[model samples]
Target: MKRFFPIVFTLLYMLAMLKPVLPVFDYVINQDYIAEYLCINKDKPEMHCDGKCYLMQMLEEQNNEKKQNLPAIDLKEYPIGFVTLINLPSETTTTTPQKNHNNYHNQYRFLTSEQHFHPPIFS
Candidate 1:
């Protein structure tokens, strides 16, 4: 179940990631077979290709397939942006508070009676 699925998924993902190396391993394991049949330079053994060309072709094909599978991005397309312009008057003015202003007081007090502190009664 739950645990088994993650393990299987991880293994599959790793195998997929290692796809490019598979051809190399195959060539290494079956060098004689590949050189005899699948190699491009098998007729001329002077190059000592030993299926290297086939392995390279396989890697290139895999890379091409990966590139083809991806979606291409459009560099010309962009999001539209909007900007707002604001206008302000050039003249500026400042005002001073009066000497007796209540805001000048450092202490504060609430004016309440005993009745105000009690909760309201329902009829």
Candidate 2:
């Protein structure tokens, strides 16, 4: 009976270790957390890849559907035309501020939480 117990225990241990080695166990388990929620609402939805919102796949499909047969011309093979290059002025020009002076400090204040006073101040 002692030999039987040890055999049974060893068999159970072996069974425990016989699980499949899953590299992509994370993606299979956490599908909801990795969904492209933005793309879900898109007019023409696209495939979700690594939880990123991409328009590349949709654009490629649309391009393929609208593709027309045209001769592939190489621009480099054509003779070079007269090239006119205009050099930009080296000096920097300052322009009037688009916004008022008060709006300048508002950028930083928007990012940070507003500071509040606990009690009314006495003059």
What are the models' TM-scores?
0.57, 0.18
**lDDT per residue (tens digit) for residues 95-116 in model 2:** 9768655634554444565886
| True-vs-predicted CA distance for residue 57, candidate 1, Å | 1.2
Overall lDDT per candidate, in order of appearance: 0.83, 0.54
lDDT of 1 by residue, 1-123 (tens): 889999999999999888778877888899889888999987898999888899889889888998999999875564344545568767776777657755575677887776646687899
Error of 2 at 122 (Å): 99
lDDT for model 1: 0.83
Q: List the residue pairs that clash in candidate 2.
A: none
Candidate 2 at residue 93, lDDT? 89
After superposing candidate 1 on the true structure, give the runs of residues whose Cα lies further than 4 Å from its correct spot: 79-123
